[model samples]
Target: MADTDLLKTPLHDLHAELGAKMVPFAGYEMPVQYPMGVKAEHLHTRAKAGLFDVSHMGQVELPDPNAARDLEQLVPGDLQSLEVGQMRYTMFTNENGGILDDLMVFRLERGLMVVVNAACKNLDIKHMSESLTGPVISHDDRALLALQGPSAEFALSALAPEVATLQFLTGKWIDVDGAKCLVTRSGYTGEDGYEISAPADQAEALARKLLAQDDVEAIGLGARDSLRLEAGLCLYGHDIDETTTPVEAALTWSIGKRRREEGGFPGADVIQKQIAEGTSRRRVGILPEGRAPAREGTEIQAPDGTTIGAITSGGFGPSLEAPVAMGYVASEHAAAGSAVNVVVRGKALPARTAKMPFVPNGYKR
Candidate 1:
């Protein structure tokens, strides 16, 4: 796509001023990395705090008293019972149990807020508009920013002290730089962080203020991808897709027990059966021997050369200082510590099915 055709975020100029390397991602010209480089930026985020311009992601609000109950028909989570200010991680499933996209559902005081992937936001909006019985209001006027890492609360607390009291997966409206913003104590980097949604016009100012903190540095998409990968969080269109079921992706934990017992959501029968009888294939963490990072599409095989499955997301885990990957494999070979081989460059490299979160999750629960 031409550079002119790429959309720019509210903080585009700021990213450019920081010498960020811009790249096209999900229909937007986003900063893939800054002058600090992916390795340094990633390490800095793990130790301190990293500010990211995630305005490309879509935010939508459902304004109806029955919003949660109406939205529950499309997802497996028990959204109807979600307390105000609570957030839940869920997937939109198709009739065949395949995931349309994974999203964060937040129950707000007046309604519900949903954060969807940049690529699938439109489709998700259309689906919700047609299926749900509420007014689906898209937040095109808002900019999303993520402040992540160990010192996230410290940096953000200076701006809004009430934010420091928020636990993981909870959010509330707060005053930041005199701007009324909705701040959530959740993020994709497996760290204790906040995803703040501010008015588009004031986003740049908020970002500038956050970046001014001693512990906060601007990070880009390159480190964002690597960080989420190390955290075992699935990237839409790569780790989880319309062809992949949540069960096959090993995300059954997000399904409520009541939903599991009483089928109501789309593909509930299929998902329940998979839960009862077990899925044929399972997503598992893969740790390759040595340093050759196995990338996406790498084929997985048994010791006997039997093709088991394939890798979906793989990369060098900066935190682990090793090559980490996740892929679907036959359930027989999906057990943690099970030995397998990954075919990279026509050679079968030894690997093992290790547990997920290559690095331990640092969420402040």
Candidate 2:
């Protein structure tokens, strides 16, 4: 894409003024890190607080009373059961049970709010519009920011005291320094944090206000990726894709029981069958034996040197101070603690199957 066509978030200039290293990601010129680098940013966030600009994600609203029913036809989550001001992580599946994209749905008054990956937002919106009969509106005027870490609640509480009361997976409208915004008690870093959605025009002001807090520091895409990886969260195009089913991705929990029994969502038959019969391959966490990080596309091999699967997402965990990754392996070899090998630079790196969330999640609820 041309440079002019690259999308810029409301805080683009602010990132530049802060001496952040810029990189193209999801068609947006985003900050990869500041002068302190990814490791420092990562550690800072875990220790205190990190502010991240995630405005590249798509913000959309469904404004019909039947919106829940309309959305239920696309994703596997039980939207109707989601109480107002609550959020749920869900997936858009195809007819074959493979994921189109994993997204967050927030139950709001008079409508449902959705946040989707930027790369697949257009396609996702088009598909949803074609499949549902509701009035789907894309909120391009909004921007998203994530404030994460142990001190996140305390820092954000200074601006919106009510935000501190929200539990994990719950959200509500709040005023941040006089700017109206939506705050969700959820994050990708396995930390007790909030994701704020506000008008694009007010995003920069909100970010600055949050950073003014003693505990909050500006983070970038580099640390954000590492944090999510350490948390064992799936990235859209990597850990999950059109070819990966929810069952195979180890995200079957996202499928509501009612949806599974009702068989109304797309690919319900195939997904329900996988739930019953099991999938041939399953996504599992892996921990390599040394400091050497495993990168994507690394071959995961059985002890016998037989290729079993490939690494989807991998990186050095700043918190664990070790190399960690998540990938699909044959069902027979998917158990935690199972011995495996990751081919790194043509050399077999000793690795072992590990349980997810390499670091424990610190959500309040």
Candidate 3:
């Protein structure tokens, strides 16, 4: 696509100012890396704090007294009992048990706020509109930013001291330099962090202020991808898609226990059956031996060269100083420590099934 055809986030100018290498991603001209490079940015984020421009993500507000009840019909999470200011990770499932998309649903004071992936926002909006009764208010005027790492709390507290009290998966509206912003103590990096949504007009200014903090530095998409990969978080298009079911993706935990028994959401029948009978395949982390990184599309093999699965997301773990990957494999091979092989560069490299989150999660909760 032409550069002119790409959409620009509110932080486009700021990214360029920081010497970021712009790339096209999810139909947006996004920053893939900065002058400091991916490794530096990744380590910096782990050691201190990093500011990420996640404004391309989609946000929607659904208002109602029974918003959770109404939204429960489309997703498997237990939204009905969700307390105000709480957030939950969930997926929009299709009738066949396939996942349409994964999202964060937050129970705000006035309604439910959902944040979806940038690529699927348009279709997600349409899907919600067709399935729900209440209005689905898309927040095109809002830009989202993420301040992630161990120093996140310390950095954000300087601007909004009230944010220091928020625990993981909790959100609240707070004032940042007089700008009303909704801040959530959650992020994709598996680090203790916050995702902030502010008016688009003020987003750049707010980001600049955050970047000015001693603990914060501008991070780009390259580091963000490696961070999430090391954390064992799924990337929408790569790790999951319309054909992957929550059961197969090792995400059944996202479904509430009551929802499992009651079986009301879409694909509940298949999901429940899998829960009872077990799935044929399951998502698991792969730790390849040696330094050679097994990348996405690499075929996973058994000891006998039997084809088992393919790598969905794979890369060098900056934090672990090793290669980490996640993919679907037969249920028998899903156990941690099970031996496996990865076909990389025409050679079967030794590997093993390992538990996820190559590095431990640092959520405040």
Global lDDT of each model? 0.94, 0.92, 0.94
Q: Residue-wise lDDT of candidate 1 within 130-230, one digit each (tens)?
A: 99878999999999999999999999999899998999999999999889999999999988899999999999999999999999999999999999999
Residue 218 lDDT in candidate 2: 97
**Residue 311 shift from truth in candidate 1, angstroms:** 0.6
- Candidate 2 — which residues are off by over 4 angstroms? none
Question: Which residue pairs of candidate 1 clash?
Answer: none
Lowest lDDT block of 10, candidate 1 = 63-72
Q: lDDT tens string, model 3, 35-104?
A: 9999999999999999999999999999876779989999999998889999999999999889999999
Top candidate on lDDT is 1
Instruction: Give the lDDT of residue 111 in candidate 2.
Output: 76
Off by over 4 Å in 3: none
As a whole number from 0 to 100, the lDDT of residue 104 in candidate 3 is 99
State the TM-score for model 3. 0.99
* Displacement of the residue 78 alpha carbon in candidate 3, Å: 0.4
Candidate 1 local lDDT, residue 158: 94
